[model samples]
Target chain A: MSLEASFADEPAFVPYLAAGDPDYESSLAYVEALARGGADAIELGLPFSEPIAEGSTIQEAIVRALEAGMTVDRYFEFVADLDVDVPLVCMTYYNLIYQYGDEQGPRPFVRKAAEVGLSGFVVPDLPAEEAGPLRDACDEFGLDLVFIVAPTTEGERLERMREQVSGYVYVQARLGTTGARDEVSDYTERSLARIEDWDVPKAVGFGIKSGDHAERIVSAGADGIIVGSALVDIVAEGHENDDATEEVAQRLEDKARELKQGALRGAGDRPRVE
Target chain B: MSTSKFGDYGGQYVPEALMPAIEELTDAYERYVLNNEDGFIDEFRQRMRDFGGRPTPLQYAEQLSARYDTDVYLKREDLLHGGAHKLNNALGQVLLAKYMGKERIIAETGAGQHGTATAMAAAHLDMPCVIYMGETDIARQRPNVFRIRINGAEVNPVTTGRGTLKEAISETMRDWATTVENTHYVIGSVVGPAPFPSMVRDFQALISEEAREQIQEQAGTLPDAVLACAGGGSNTMGTFHHFVDDSAVDLYAVEAGGSSLSVDEEAGVAPNSASLSTGEEGVLHGARTKVLQDTDGQIMESHSVSAGLDYAGVGPELAHLVDSGRVDPVNVDDDVALEAFHRLSQDEGVIPALETAHAFGYLEEHHDELGDTVVVNVSGRGDKDLETVIEETMERDLSIAPDMSIFREVGGGAL
Candidate 1:
């Protein structure tokens, strides 16, 4: 009876990669590798002319993706042909959505996105007020409009956000862009506590570096974790060598397994170093 | 046939997404301009009279002319709505869009003048309008930003590229590509693809159309030379059109050179946007004339404090004229432009846009050359540039006399 329960038991979230930095065959293989891993969900990022929030690592990934001639329609094509076993979320900017969306703007993009077998969408710039049109369209199309709540979000905004959003809440651990960081702020601690009280599933991101960070976030209250810059860095490192596709996939799998193992171990027993 | 073939330089170059719309524009422009239809001209001319507040006056700059020993006639385009000659073309495009049945309008602007004007027109017609401006421009020109928004248009801040005019154009192009089906891309200047360069030139050529008759009645002959600045070459070409075939009237196009000309920065290079000076005859952004590019054939971006002239290329028609020895192009440094800005403000009681100061700079350079007569296009007023002038003057005064002790004691100094 619970359509969402089926996905609840699904494996940990897996982030997909575009192969050859942009090479078609290699990228196709990379998507398959992500599916082969215990990834319950896959996030496929489409290259855009501008990526405002993406850090250097993901920016480079996009450059390679673009160099491989990736486009809005081509991303849809890859999704259609892949036959991968997981819910797919397209992570991208609002510019591409604005360009490709319908007369009302982002809503049109969300509607068409639903038609293309997409399970959800994650847009950085579409704030909650602006997200309404997209949310309404997604509801009509039966697609999830995933929203992001940063550590700095207050009670009023958080309550307002919970009423309209679905799928899951992305809890940003730090104030800046998505990348590895040396320290976590007290604001992040308060936010994690606040997110733990929410009814919906929570996913922590931003400065989430290794398996330990993911494990700590999950044990704190996160149902899952999203890793981008760290995974992108590994992919970039592998790109310097001769067969980067499989190697990068192996590296991602190793990290994913580590996070999964850590999730089971829990962060409660670990001494509070902070 | 004239070497200035509108065909070679006025061809279209647009992304595949907006090809249909551009092609339609080309067809509509040709149909309207070339057709012997009296209805189109009647409507266009009537609008210019009633709505556009034309024919703009041609006042003799008695002080400047006497100062330089030349009979300087000033074409007063700054009085027009939106405060520049830019409205001449904006009115033309808005009417054209109405005829074409397009429901929405999209445009790009720097310094927010053109965007402000376009927003005015769209507001008048009750058409939905979207304006893409560089984030930096939006901040610098915040007053104009609020003006356009109040006029019922949305301003989309473009954060890409160097966050200036060129980036704004790129954003506009991208938006046009997507909304081409229902939107009319109202290019702010005489840049972009074919028909646009020529189209905007033709609309703005009204400056010369009236000036020619006025000059003949007053001076008993055509002026010896006509000078104007060449930012996107709109005003320069608009004034130069009537005299292109006169053979006796010399034409000079001055470009911006900010600060010291010899300063290593790309400030005031004579050929900044002067096609003949910096460009090889190649296609760029649609128009086939001269474009500024590197040795590897990539477009070399241009820089100027004046957003209007900050482009890498000039209109191809202007390029042909400069190349064929018909028009002379010169560079004007920012110091000269600032001086001219002050002179025009103090002496004439009119503030000209920094873009138009390039022409004023040219007049300063050739003060001795003009023995008898000259006419300069006072393209736009400097209301938009008060901040620039004040800031630049303050900087100069500070550098000249930085000692706080001297300034404190200088309360006894003369005003």
Candidate 2:
């Protein structure tokens, strides 16, 4: 229940796309493309109306995603049918899980997820104190309960999080809602240092646009990088351009590696490991 | 009557996530009615009298009545503790929220009337209260800002959207999504999610409910017409609810026209807040209602001198009532409303808020038509607007921007 395996081998993580902005089949192609583009793992986003912490870009994408008829069961079925080589992570809000679980617990989602070959779950709002029941359920079902940490997180909680947190630590690059940003902030650099101190393989997200941004997060000491809205935006824009799904998927894969390359370059600039 | 139909107009156009909440509210209200007998109504009245300072007297405006040709009866909802008729609905929603296992109360406001009332009710219940207001409104309604804070409620300034009612509603919705586990969003107006539209009407129905019985005792018969200004149409609906079913009663909802209806786009009505008079059918802030929009469905700007009546859409239920001929919406110009405010202050010795002045102005026109009998709901006192009015009058030469046409029917002058 740790990132020990994924961390040992550097692999590309892809973001699952929903078709149309609110369209369905378009998203199916998006997932296929990401898989074809060499995505090591995929994260499927479940859309909700009040995503309080999401930026306008992701918010709109979610709206589009939901409009495309993205549902929890649908995502599971999509993964089950696809010949995806990578592990799958389902990203959703607490309400969806609560509703899916009948407000009882996360056992329902975990059980359904296991049946669908889903490897892990990422719920951004679930604090560690409240993560226990879900974590235990995930453990029972041989699924990982992925926890996310932000730049402004306190040190004690970060350490406690490092000890109890399963799967990989999702280290967000910056603060202020989830979205795409143009430049890396000094705050992100400081946060990377904090994540590095935990000595765990951290996957940095939030505003990871180009390979360069991805490179920066990696150089900042991240082992894996999660690219979401940028990839979703690429797919959305590609759909508008009438570009082939494979091309869009290929572009996303290229961008992920490009970001990784930038991080590698930055890593080379870091003081050498003994 | 408006073109927007409630039967046809008030359909659920919300996201699937909100449907359950709406259903829950509808169910709760239906159950409340089944359990709420005359004894329950009497108990509610007793609580309002003992705690909320109700049985708000009907003040006779003899001087104004003499100045005009007809006798004017003022239903003094402004005398209620919290300075407006908002308390009636606040008590109802807060009590309902308590029953729903909601430990916290959230509200959105433009004029702070509803915010203040909600804060007062929340304080009374010792519940945590959060009010989302536009940053712009927070700057103008300082007295209410201080009042809510003093009463142990947090005022979260919403800087998003147009920074008015629309923005406030958006923020409140966002808060509700996260806090839904322990929170009930007590919308001030008779708008928002379905249950809110229905729930708020039931609570504020006290105004017309008591007025019907009380007016019957005073005048020996029902009045010819019931008048109140429409800003989300809460106060009007509150007083008009009991009368809506009364075939003999005429219900009139006056909208702020900002002095002249012909002066297109000069009035600064916060478009998202104004529902009647100008708003078209559209979904906004999570409710299907009347919104002021352009040909392309883009929301248009709204205007009114009073912040309270500055919304762009009327409540969906009110829209329905207006469309179904259950309620009539009349637009009032700013000049007429201001004149009414001054006349009421000088003659009746009761300074009325600009929003209430809209109803006062409507009454001023209909006194002759209605003969001697009429009841107008004075929604709020005018103290908050004294400085603003005085400043505006003193700086008469200051250039105010052009606003949207206030009246659908143009005239020579409002006075």
Evaluated with DockQ, which candidate comes out highest? 2
lDDT of 1 by residue, B1-415 (tens): 1222464455544432344466678778878754624366567778778877889888888788777878888888888777888888777787788777899998888878888888888887778999989897887777789988999999999766456666677667766654566789888777776668778888889999998888887787898888888877888889999899998888988887644323222221322444445555544554556655432233445666676777766787787788778988787866677778777766677788888888887898886775466778888988887665555655564332224354336533321
Give the CA lDDT, 0 to 100, for residue A154 in model 1: 60
Model 2 TM-score, 2 decimals: 0.62
Provide chain B TM-scores across all predictions.
0.89, 0.88
User: Which parts of model 1 are misplaced by more than 4 Å?
Assistant: A1-274, B1-8, B36-38, B260-276, B280-282, B397-415
How big is the positional error of residue B128 in model 2, measured in Å on the Cα after superposition?
Answer: 0.8
TM-score (C-alpha, index-matched) for candidate 1: 0.60
What is the alpha-carbon interface RMSD for each candidate?
14.8, 12.2
Docking class of 2: incorrect
**lDDT tens digits, residues A96-201, model 2?**
5644644455688788878888788877655554467678888899887776776556556566567667677777666545667788756666766777666556
Ten residues in sequence with the least summed lDDT for candidate 2 chain B: B399-408
Provide the lDDT at A90 for model 1.
Answer: 79
- Stretches off by above 4 angstroms in model 2 are A1-274, B1-5, B37-43, B259-274, B397-415
